[model samples]
Target: MQETQDPVITSVKPKSRFPKSVPYIIGNEAAERFSFYGMRSVLTLFLVNQFFNPTDNPALTDQANAHANKLHHLFVMVAYALPFVGGMIADWFTGKYKLILYVSIIYCIGHVMLATFDGGLSGFELGLLVVAIGAGGIKSCVSANVGDQFDATNQDLLSKVYGWFYFSINAGSMISTVAIPWTYEHFGPKWAFGIPGILMALATIIFFSGRKKYVKVPPQGVNRNNLVFITWYALTHGSQRKKGEAFLDVAKQNFDPERVEGVKAVYRVMMVFFFALAFWAVWDQCLSEWTLYAEKMDRVVNVGFAKFTIYPGQLSTFNTIFLLMFIPLFNYVIYPWFDKRGIKTTPLRRLGTGLVLTALSFVIIGVIHTSLDHGGSPSIWWQVLAFLVLSAAEVLVSITGLEYAYTHSPKSMKSTMTGIWFLVVSFGNLITAVVNGLIEGGGWWATALKGANYEWFFVGFILVFVVIFFIVSPRMKERNYITDPVIDGEVAANTNSL
Candidate 1:
């Protein structure tokens, strides 16, 4: 039997300061998020109010809610699904740096397309296609690039760095989510869409500023075939002929140790992703289902300066606003405080807590829905409470997820596994799309949920899976992966699951 050893990561000297590239990357992310969420804040409203007029077709008017929601989810589903192709290209062909640069330009063009042909269905569809391609293509690389900035010596700082990363994202998101809605209402759709395009241009420029400062991982080249060959060789060699052998045990017995280790890492990542997949279903609702619910409520605010009425969609900003506050609190005070007490707040534990909080947010939503159904106009303050809970859930699941995917992924497949992580989110949206299709088709679910209305959406059902995954998550093998120097002529990935 061959006994090839896996390369062990060597500890390097930790830099006294964070990488010079980090601020630039964080700046780029903030601006890019502003561009992305700014457009997203008003998309459904544009489609419903302008793209298709209710006066022309009564059926379109009646089903406008479902149609707009479905379209929004479909856009998200396609955007996330495209990352698999993007991840493969980044990992095996063009490296992440170049791929991100190229795709981001396309993203800017998409914003221009949306701005130019405001409210046209055909143009909207085309723009969404191009934007999805560009956004999904770059998403995998960007997240992994954050981790590439650190190595074994300072890997402990990754979680905190990701928190700040997410903080930047929400900083941009909070602003755009609030400002864009007002822009759409006052200035117009063209201006609103154009603003995001301008931000995208700035984002590209900011990213390029970090070019020399970043540690760029070169393309590893394609070796998916090696995986297939190893699997075949193991099965044929009778390596599984032992008591209590599990599936893939033959590969472990016959393949190199590095290959077996890579396989194990991949397996652990898969387990975490399943739970993450469920978490996304609830988290993403802040954009889709929750917005629809918001439109039904009253929106009056007194900032002590003046009394102002706002759009319901603008309420989405609350999630980001709270994130801006909470991320720091947890990173500096809360998490550190717990560490002093020897309470281990591992990623898995945080994930489980996030799940429980997510379910609680839905319960709050359900209560609000009941009031709305009974013709009691609940104040917007009630939503603040819900957003606090939900945003806490997000801090746990989404932010931790970014760090988790990069750290847990096999060295060779960093970008590829990150892409797969996004695909899990895609699957969540697909599930929502399917269920909505059934409800739209006027099936038994539609009849059953008629009175329940918006409250009938799957909070408890998703929570059930979250609990199941949480129970299984402690069993997930946790490991710390740092940026390692490439070994000559050795494949970065050792697993057979390319």
Candidate 2:
């Protein structure tokens, strides 16, 4: 990796230069990733056979791909939805760390139930919901907590920390996705899932152990105040305002003049959050529908030492593997080269590229599906390439977005904004559910799969979103909120504390 000076890098220190907090966060993230990917990697396969409708027939399976797709879509949809609720819970009652710890326990419970009992449709669905609730709570809090470790004083290291943080997530995911699926395939479902449950338990324990080492930023009610101020500002500045503005009459009592700039700043961040809905709608499919598609492909690998069998759901591991490899290369080498040439590598640029790359990934899958439709047996390398491309895009968008959103939002509203980001994924999964339903109906599914047009359907769907996001990108603010300090009677020196 090159050491060329980038404005982004100069503005934020190398995460390597930071204190011990980096290791703590990385450790927590690794364990969390192991728990998440271990379960998620096998969710589609488990739902179709082990949990929902236990089966043994090979050629014509008891539960078809369509049913698995629908179940996968709904599971992902709820997982994304619960984050909003979890974020709110963190804000109003429990703090972020507390919420993460508590929900993770519930998450472990869900895995235990899946591993131990006869989880039929209702039982399995309940387990998925529990997992979602736990995941949502943790997802809402954890990334921002990583940011909490650094302030403006040491914020120069933020990009590096974020890079390393993402690396840890992939490391954990790669192991679980590959190993857990293999275990399930051969050793049986109990060991596959039970192992993840143990990992989750360990993660929760690790988090509690490091409670004192973490940054304890509580959720402040900044949004509620911002809304009141906006209402007042609208009423006072209106050309059609009466002698006594009715909206301002109600709003003025709650508005504090001392926090006016802070209120405006929070609103500005909200502006960017509104645009990400479409990006996530397309991004979430990698887990939900894509997994099922990969499952259908033939993935028998014959190595010298042993014969390796690949599961469709386990293909997600490739994304994580590539993510681990690419983040450092891009952050240290690729972005720096671009930066030397005066190209902007800010969060917005990364995010825009992510949108495009996601579209491209679907395009690749669509092409494969098209060839396979003509009775072609596509090589596994195609899927591998797709994961590689998608991982590059993941680094550009997903990891950067996590770092960006956490740093940019009002300190008090961090969890809420994280929840919003997850909500965008929820919306995406919901859209996927609708799309899946459409494909299942009106002769479309048969035509696409039989004619190898499934690739076209997937490609066409993503292209539609790619165009939508392109139009939306310009409206997004390129300048970061992290650079702008919200003054609220605290000394400027304390800005980093936020």
Candidate 3:
């Protein structure tokens, strides 16, 4: 697993305006993140304020909370789903750059609608749908395109590029979380959402301005080929044939072995996608119920040190900030330490750690909420502590997982892999919606709140799924090809799992 000699590696050089290119992308990412998160941070609050209750009555607050949670999950579900369609569009017709530009415009338009459409419930719902489509489309396309900038040669620089990317994202989150929440408190939704919409427009323009310098990979025409599908269909049917099915019916019928191998790789990744649903079920609530929980908590003031108010939604920024910090920390410290000990931080191991850590993070949250239910608000330090652990787990899992999927996936299926990643989140959101509905309908939430809190129930269910995933992850890693710069052109020797 460890090699002293450097492998034959290709270096992706910086473009002519290398400095400018990085900033442009980073700036665009930062602004776009701000726009997206800003709107999201306040969406639940807005719904609760407006449509959540038709009349001002304290008794109707529960109804409002239920409605807001439903809307939040629905927005999240659609947001994750649209990426599949957006990725397909990029892989087929317009390519990433053009698709980003087009979808971004739609995203901004959705924002504008959100800011202005303060009419009836129907108008608000319509606005959310538009924003979801636009935002989801952009998310699906832009993120994949970020990887398109580097290839085999410049792959080593990916860590650094992604580091900056994470930094920009966190920075944007910091501002949006603080500012948007504040705006919603002081000003109206129009002002709060309008500012983010304006920023999104600027982000789009900035991305397009740097278009000439970016590496633009045309989509691989694999899916467009009729022979591939015909071969796949034959293979599918052949598997269902009676005992002693003939190879001539499947293997010999216009099937290419290489294409078969590619398909197997894609399927392997998709199989692993199921495990991720549990992770997202826990992870995505950072924006939904978790924020609501935070809104209800006591805010700590450190007037002796620095005078400033802390918002619960702003705490999510810790994930991004820690991501930025961990990018360099892992690359410089952890990777080298592991390399010295003759250990490879395989994606499976990373993902497993992420799941465990995420579960632990929720446990901490459960404990804090338990304290709150016991007639006392917990310290903000508890939330911060959980964030620290969660962020560490995120570095191990989500970042590594993204790189793993990108490299393991065949070039033709890069966008497909991205879409699959989001699909896991979509499924998770769907599960969350179901759980929320059940909790609301059956009124089982009160039972859990009696002890260490009901949020623990969600955490426990997710952790159970995660433990099962760990049992299977070793085999999953074995199935994937190690597509690292250190192992160029050398396929993994252990491909028996496939």
Deviation of model 2 at 429, angstroms: 1.5
Clashes of 3: 3
Where is the poorest 10-residue window by lDDT in model 2? 489-498
Query: Who wins the lDDT comparison?
Result: 1
Residues 104-190 of candidate 2: C-alpha lDDT, one tens digit per residue: 889889877767753456776777677676776677678767877877677778888877887788788888888887888887777
Expressed as tens digits, the lDDT of each residue in 270-362 for candidate 1 is 777788777776566678766666766777889898998867668888877787788878778887898899886777777788888888888
Q: Kindly report which residue stretches of model 3 are placed more than 4 angstroms away from their true locations once superposed.
A: 1-24, 53-63, 144-163, 208-222, 225-236, 239-252, 335-344, 442-453, 474-477, 483-498
Best by TM-score: 3
Q: lDDT for model 1, on a 0 to 1 scale? A: 0.76
**Model 1, C-alpha of 442: deviation from truth (Å):** 2.7
Clashing pairs in 1: none
Worst 10 residues of 1 by lDDT: 489-498
lDDT for position 11 in model 2: 62
Models 1 onward score TM values of: 0.80, 0.76, 0.82
* Superposed model 2: Cα runs more than 4 Å off: 1-28, 50-63, 144-165, 209-223, 226-253, 256-278, 296-298, 302-307, 342-349, 403-415, 440-454, 469-479, 482-498
Please list all clashing residue pairs in model 3, or write none if there are none: 10-153, 12-153, 12-154
In candidate 3 the C-alpha lDDT for residue 383 amounts to 81
